[model samples]
Target: MRGLIAAAVGALIAGNIAAAAADNSFAVRDVRVFDGDKTIPLATVVVEDGRIAVVRRDAPIPAGLMVIDGHGKTLLPGLIDSHVHVFPGAEADALRFGVTTELDMFDISRDFKTWKAQRTSLGRTGQADTWAAGLGVTVKGGAPLEMLPPGMSVPTLDSAADAQKFVDARVAEGSDYIKLFIETLSEYHDRRTMPTLSRAEVCAVVAAAHADHRLAIVHTQAEWAAREAIECGADAIAHMIPDRVVGTHFIALAKRHHIFFETTDDVWAGASGMDFAQKLARDPRVAPYLSPMQRATLLATEKKVTPRFFPTVLANTRALHAAGVPLLAGTDSPNPATAHGVALHEELQILVRAGFTPQEALHAATALPDAIFHLGRRGRVAKGYRADLLLVDGDPTTNIAATLSINRIWMNGYPVDRTLPKK
Candidate 1:
């Protein structure tokens, strides 16, 4: 969902740092641990060889090892941003704000190879690990093509058979999931009409992805399109529909099918001419970490209330949550008014406003997204999980904004330098 290359450059630009600790191990003593689902009060967490070695209330602190004081702080699993567009340095920016992993919804950059290599190593890279939908499946000249930069092309399908081929090719390309652009929303703030894949084509791609053992995520913004996606058995929906109030029937259908959603509220707020993005950018807690691109992108969004569907977006999110549906916190970042890490924190607050307790909202950003997308061994602070953790000033379990009070962050058990980047 990111914009122009120049704008991306501004966000990705960062101040650099040196290598990891000599042994890549440490311990956080006497901390309140949010182990993704529940809380562990006054625990000692040991990290060794880039994974959690021990988690106990009174774990032995080995002599001669580095120990970070966790007094008055809450430690949580480093965040997993459910949706983003990864440009270079995007991962670093995410890590700067405690997001250790990213679920990239769409890209043609083919950086997943490098991402995998970096993640496999135990060295400190100061970047978030990533899983991407390398090239989304769409009709020829479909949804994103209109949104993409000029001359940038992704493979397209003509029929259901073509959709099948695209699925296989996407799998071969190392896409972590399948993305189907099924957009046909009759109205939008942008007011740009584009072609979308048909129901048969959407079904073909979803079926093939399942056969290949890939999760299929559909991009739809209308109630009808979402209904079709659920019936076609999409693993998830990319964005909440904004055109109208979501119905009980649809909520039941989603639950029956076990469909999770990525809440890209920032994207729709910009679309509906709301100041949600601007207000978040101006947040005193969040503003200091903004890169030049984040500042530019956030402030440059159009300020018109085209179509005015912002209320419906919030209503649907509340309705869905009230029905006990799992919602993942995602900012379609580097999009119009959304930046990478900063936008995700804003989403946590928005979820809280939508009736999610701070703890439940934290789960949406941490455990839920990781499990829903099958990102293994990195979403919790339990023993043997990857040692990607965040230490913040206040207990985020009680106040979601406490996530932004980041005191320290670790990726693969190596301390991350949280200093603002020197663009």
Candidate 2:
């Protein structure tokens, strides 16, 4: 009986895969284009063979191309979340809110290779494209181990050799980038401490990643750890500092090093109140795109009562941006009050509230991540690029909230099914 059930499930999965690869050509006409840098008032975008073939004003529509009327709509590159710990069902939920790409900070799944292949294949649809750091490098009793299952061995680096070995193993496993956990855990649990990677070890790991031509990103919460990560040659900081306000000197260092920061203020804000999550949960515009599981997660109560850190996070983000340090918008989804996909929209609002112009906030989620991570042919609406695009009803360049008014989403030129299934 179990074998029969397994076979049936496998067949259903295969059928869905086949259906996702069916459509790969279309044209969206008469839409305002946000080409990752500036806005074009009126333009036509044509997609053929899963690539954007033409983007111009008054272009002649070739015969046999499915034309989608984009009058009174805004076409932008699909959103990208730079920091997320993905599991099953996350990608589909991400796509529902027009997030066509998710940059996973850490993933431990054994089937990661399979998922990566599926995301890269031409004509793929339904789920967001994923790039991940297969397994984060951390100390034995450090962060993430507390959240992971018992007896699961995580690489603990105490020396430079260990760091090199760990990075090499991750590279062999096809990790897109290297993720380092530099958390101290003192703030999360009072009077308790966790082991952290030494500076030498971190430097070694970063050097190894650079030697392999991969970016090294670090997860840190305190200003001190963030400074250390930067000093150790980390290409990016995965989370904002929440313990205290960041100083201009630190911002200058980040700017000098060309280090990008991912603002995860939503995760911190969710703990103090449900405002962010509740707003999305109550939003009628996004209601149909959210799955049952995503809706429930968004509405769930906060489990941990950590000190309010969003204020500090927001202030630091503002300071960093003012100092010319590049910022990337990310919501640490499925963490507590934050859900997948929709939380990114909230993050953009937070950025706007924290002194970023709406256009800058939009670029943080799109072009910045692509440029920093070297994700070629994405995060832009241009000819010779993948047809990963989002069509919204309003001008998001001026009003960040307009991103939520999602009308259509295309991944590799294939339209997404926005309707939720009936229970």
Candidate 3:
């Protein structure tokens, strides 16, 4: 049904369209809105005080509200990146592509409380609001430790018994969730190996996180490792393995456990020598926004000489989607050949290739991740939701790629400038 927020029928109204840039109280007429879950064809959406006040069909503009023309455009809830590692300038970069929220897998900024406080009182912000895994739990010297800056010694678990105390410390530091690492695949192509927390340790850490009311997002790169983590009650798997075709048992196990996956498509594609970053750099819609470092990193991000596992990975993802497994769109960005904001759109594109409909892919990026991560009122365009929104030039539901043609944007009810940054 259509939800039209139109100008009053020959009655008094307040400000012109220009005023909506500063005022959140406004209604736009004749736009198709994808409200995260479904579409309201030709609806009027009312935003007041940074929140969606009404979403109805054929509704006259309330008195004293600004009205804008929305012909030939589509509106959607601002996108959410289900997986990212927030570094300096990452959030703003993401926002440029209309990604209003980022779920940070790991960061030790110790500013989560500040972030929480800021979002609760939103007026305007350049960066996307984040909830992070303050420190990922790993072995004493394992996995990402080699990738961290020298002298950065994050906490590690020695045994299952200490899991509770470790989670407590993270909670005290204002970590919004728990990230458990498992990198025990010793048979790499290079024959190099990494230590990992034992299965017992994984189970214990998951229990501790649940006890503290936090979701456990496990990092497992191997198929067996992912299945094992689910057996231990993980809330979500951070990255689905690209090493082999996902088995039916694993799919059934995941479905039975009610577990979801962060679809890190670009990571696997890049590892398989797909040149994902170069593809992004070539997109006219995305290239102009790339910073110098973003450009450099996109080309330099991980690349392997010989392609491997990507075909299998694609097959597994298609199977998972076909089996009705919940998949959240995430690009393990800035890894190799991936940038922040733009990578997420590429991710949705990949999901479409993996058999998700354009609307389903949008849900994975918006409402699904927001609701799964407990980010309140941010993923949908329903009444009482936050007014984080994007208005693009065409129908993304049909073109899928039309998301890049951004028209206007609102973050917490404040219009985004979308100018090129000076970075």
Candidate 4:
């Protein structure tokens, strides 16, 4: 009789273990779902095996699945910051601000691949998915030459033949898009100003990139270079030129070619010369980084441009929005002025003020950017989309600022720890 009881107990334990394994699904219940257009209440989203298996209204909980009681929280597709430069601790900051995906515009291929791998590992360990464009290929001494320290400048080819060689080398090195930097005609013409690639050189780079099935994003102000970039089939304009109003021609062309625009107007609108002058004069975060000469320049900018010059910057961005071109959210983060993470949220708020509806701004941050980059399996909350999503305490459809109050983030169906304190 004892032998019979032992065998029966082993059979019962095996059945219970199998039942627990089957119950490993997750159900997020009673949440407000922002289904990319409208918000619906009392929605339940189910995830199993890292995919959203079901979305139903007032659905009963499936046995064995873990349930996340939403407590009337708002749910939306995870935010995407189309352009940023990542540094340490960016993952934490992104989750805190509801940014589920971040794209770096100028990272080395090897380092970028490593970052991508680590980001995937972070997702497995519950962090946001991180992506980057491997490097910005520019004329060695062009616009970036203006900012880079001596000896660190990337190469600038003199002739179209040299440009082809440069392009070939970069492709072999695994670059994503060829990034050309054009600031002024003088920079190209006058070697003293900043040695820039000739027009033929630029065209050669673009052609090479296209031949290799890559795109080109040119960093240029409105000028001959900008016009030339458009004519040469550049995939995107990195920023909106503020010096002159862009005419209907570029807009019509952009629409026709499906070219994208990343209006990084936030960097210009939120110029920190005045604020940083004050902060560098006294604050702890920046004072350490400033040399005495750098501090002097910051102080001088406040006296020169703070009150009168900023209005023009705001006016230009407003005009760009009226053009109805495809605008992507880019913060120019990790730069000296714009802070990373929360800065993209601020950029979205600025975008809304610049004439986009809350939904439109959210769309720019999510769907529009994803579509532009051809990033598959991200930027949505549908059944087949990657499980990159966020939860908020308030309805974003009502108040877009609720996006700033990110409560939880899920990347690849794994819960990431909130950088902000839990409510």
Q: What is the lDDT of residue 97 in candidate 3?
A: 81
TM-score winner, 2 or 4:
2
Model 3: per-residue Cα lDDT over 1-423, one tens digit each: 122335452222345445546776778788899999888789888888889988887777889887777888889999998888888888888888899988889876767876787668767887778778878899887877788888878778989999999999998888888999988654244776778899999999999999999999999887888988999999989986776788888899999999889988877887778866687898888788777666776777453443666777778789999998889999877787677888888888888888889999999999998888889889999999999999998899877888988888888988887777863
Candidate 4 has its poorest 10 consecutive residues by lDDT at 301-310
Supply every candidate's count of residue pairs whose N, Cα or C atoms clash at under 3 angstroms: 0, 0, 10, 3
Where does candidate 3 clash, by residue pair?
Answer: 3-43, 3-44, 3-56, 3-57, 4-57, 4-58, 5-44, 301-336, 301-337, 302-336
User: What TM-score does each of the candidates earn?
Assistant: 0.91, 0.91, 0.93, 0.77
Worst 10 residues of 1 by lDDT: 13-22
Q: What are the Cα lDDT values of the candidates?
A: 0.84, 0.84, 0.84, 0.64
- What's model 4's TM-score? 0.77
> Stretches of candidate 3 above 4 Å error?
1-20, 185-190, 303-306
Models sorted by TM-score, best on top? 3, 1, 2, 4
lDDT of 4 by residue, 1-423 (tens): 999899999989888766544443577898988765456776898877666777788777778786788875887777888776565555555655567788766653235556557554423543345666455556555566555556564555667776667777766665656677666544223344555666777778788778877778877755456677777778877765545555677556666766677766655553423252344235443344333333443344322233432344455456656666678888766554455455566677667767777777778888787787776666766676666778877776667667756666676666665433333
List model 2 lDDT by residue over 1-423, tens digit each: 999999999999888665644668778899899988889999999888888999999888888677779888899999999988788888889988899888888877835676678767776567888888888888778877788777777666667887777888898988999998888865554766778888888888899899888899999877888899999889988888878887768878898898988898888787656378888888998776788778887887666655567777778888888888888999888777677898899999999988999888989999888888877688999998888899999899899899999988888888888776567
Question: Which of the numbered candidates is closest to the native, going by highest TM-score?
Answer: 3
In angstroms, give how far residue 268 of model 4 lies from its true place. Answer: 0.9
